[model samples]
Target: MDRINYQHLYYFWMVAKQGSVTAACEILHLAQPTVSGQLAVFEQAVGAKLLRREGRKLVLTDTGRAVFHYAEEIFALGREMAHMLKGRTTERGVRLNIGVSDAMPKLIAYRLMAPVLKMSEPAQIHCVEDKTERLLTEIGLHSIDMMLSDVPATPAAGTRIFNHFLGESVVAVFAAPTLAARYRDDFPRCLNGAPFLLPTTNTALRRSLDQWFDSQQISPVIQAEVEDSALLKTFGAAGAGLFFSPYAVSSEIQRQYGTQMMGLAEGVFERFYAITAQRRLKHPLVAAILENAQQGLFDLLDKPAAAD
Candidate 1:
C-alpha cells in the first residue's frame, strides 16, 4: 500500500553493481552503514531478501538477480532519456527485443520479422539466438519481449508465457543444383541413403522428420545433425547434404543460399508460434507480423508445395 522508495532502490542497485557496500559507498560518496541500511530497507519494502554475505562480498539471491536486472533496465532507460534530451542519441525508433530459437530457420525468422521494418516508423530490432529453454528463461525474466520458435510453448513449464499461433507450413527440402537434379526425379524416395543435413535429435522438427522417414520406410544418411538451422542450410548450400526448411521461406532460402527446392515433404509440417510473456498479443509489430503471415505471405505454403 506504499509507493516504491527510489532512493533505497538506487543504493541497492549500486551495491549490486559494485559487489560490496564499501565499494558502492566509495562511488556514491556515502558512509558504508548508510548504503547497507538502504539495502536492508529495500529488501524489507520488497518483502524479498536481495543479497547474502559470501566472505566480505555480497552475492545476489535468485530474487535479487531479478531485481538487479530490472534495476539495470531502469537506469538504462534513465541514461537513454538523458541522451535523448541532449540530442546525443541517434536511435529514435521503437525498440523490440526478439529471441529466436536455434531450431527456427533463419530465412523464416527474417520473413517473420520483416514486417517490423516496414512499419510507418521502423523499430530497432535486437535479436538473440539461443536454445528454446534458455529463451524461455529470458522470457520469464522479462529480458525479451517475445520469442519466435518452431513449436508452441508447452503449459507444463508453468512460466505464464502465452503462445500466439503465427501459422504452420509443411517442410521443403533444398539442395544445390547438381544435388537437386540428382534427387528431383526420385524426390522423397531419393532421400533414402542420401546425404542429409538435419536438426539434432532433440528438436521437434527432427523428431517429426524421423517419424515421417520411418513411416515411409526410408532411412537417409544424416551427414550431420545440427542444432542451428542456419548452419544446416549453410552445409546444404555447400552441397554437404540436402536440408529441410519451412516452405514459408523456401524462395528466400533458394535466393539467399543459391539452393534449389526439391519439393514439400509429405506429412511433415513446421508449425510456428510467437511466444510472449504477456497473456494477450499486444505489440504492434508482432501483430503486423502475424497479420502478414496469415495473409499472402503463407498463401502458397498453405498448399502442398513451394511457390515457384
Candidate 2:
C-alpha cells in the first residue's frame, strides 16, 4: 500500500462533513476533478471504501465515519500548533480571544473593533458573544482572554483592567401612541396594569426592574418574557407590548423607525467593564487590546453627534 497522503485525507474529511463534493471543493478552493481524483487515490491507499452515493447525497461508509473522527482531531491540533507558533514569532502578535455578553450593543461592539483591525494586524482576534454569566465563566476558565460586560452579580475572580461608566440611561416602559392616548393623563399609571415585555427573571437588569416595581407596588402584566434584550426591543418596536429598556435603545430604535421614548422617572443605568486574568495583564498584546477597548468606548459612545 502507498503512503496515505495527508492532503487527500484533509479533503476527505471536509467532503464527509459537508456531504457534497461540490461543497468540499468550494471550501478547499480546488477544482472538482482534482478533489475527486484525490479522494479516489485516498480510498485506494486506505484499502477500503469511504463514501457511497445515496440518492442525490454522499453518505460516509462505516469506515469513513471512523476515519473522519480522527481526521478532525488531527486537523484541530495542527491549527492550534500553527496559531501558537505565529504568536511566538511576533512581539505584539497574539491570538486574543474575547467573550462578550449579548447585552452589549452590536453596533458598539463592531465600532470598537474596527479601529483595532485597521491600525495593526499584529494580533488575530476572535470574539464570542454569550450571556454575562457564561462569558465571565469563559474568562475565568482561560478559554477566553478577556471580557466586556455589565458587572456580574458577584465579582469575577480577575483583575479589573478598566471600568468605564456608560452613564445613566433611562429605562422606560414604552407603549404605542394609541395606548398612551387611551390612558391619557394617567398613562404612567397605566403601565402598572399594561402587559410588559421583559428580560428573563435571572438577569441583573430584570432583577433591578423587579425591585423598582416592587417598591412602587406596581405589578406589570408581563405578556412575553425573553432572555435576549435585542428581541425585546424588536417586540417593543413592533408594538407587541410595552417594554422596559435603556435610553440607548430608545434612541437607536427612534432613529431607525418612528417611535417614542417614555420617561421611566425611575432613573436606572447599566455600567460596563473590561476584565482580564491577573497574570495576563502583563502580556503585551493583551495590554494593547485593553487600552484600545477603553479608548474606543469613549470615541464610539461619548462623542458628539457631529463626531458620530
* Residue range with the least summed lDDT across 10 consecutive positions in model 1: 298-307
Q: In candidate 2, where is summed lDDT lowest over 10 consecutive residues?
A: 160-169
What would the per-residue lDDT of candidate 1 be over residues 39-101, giving only the tens digit for each residue?
888899899999999999999887887788778767777888999899895554667778999
Task: Point out where model 1 deviates above 4 Å.
Answer: 11-41, 49-62, 87-90, 300-308
Model 2 regions lying over 4 Å from their true place: 1-96, 105-125, 153-168, 175-187, 282-308
Cα miss at 253, model 2 (Å)? 2.6
Count of backbone clashes for each model? Answer: 0, 0
Q: Write the residue-wise lDDT of candidate 2 on 1-308 in tens digits.
A: 65668998999999999999999999999999999999999998999999999987899776786677568657866877787788744334455677777776454455445555655556567798898776665555555677766564355344543343433344655656655444435546656777778878866677888887787777888889887666776777677777766554455555653446565637455555566665556655556655666555543453324535
Instruction: State every prediction's TM-score relative to the real structure.
Output: 0.81, 0.57
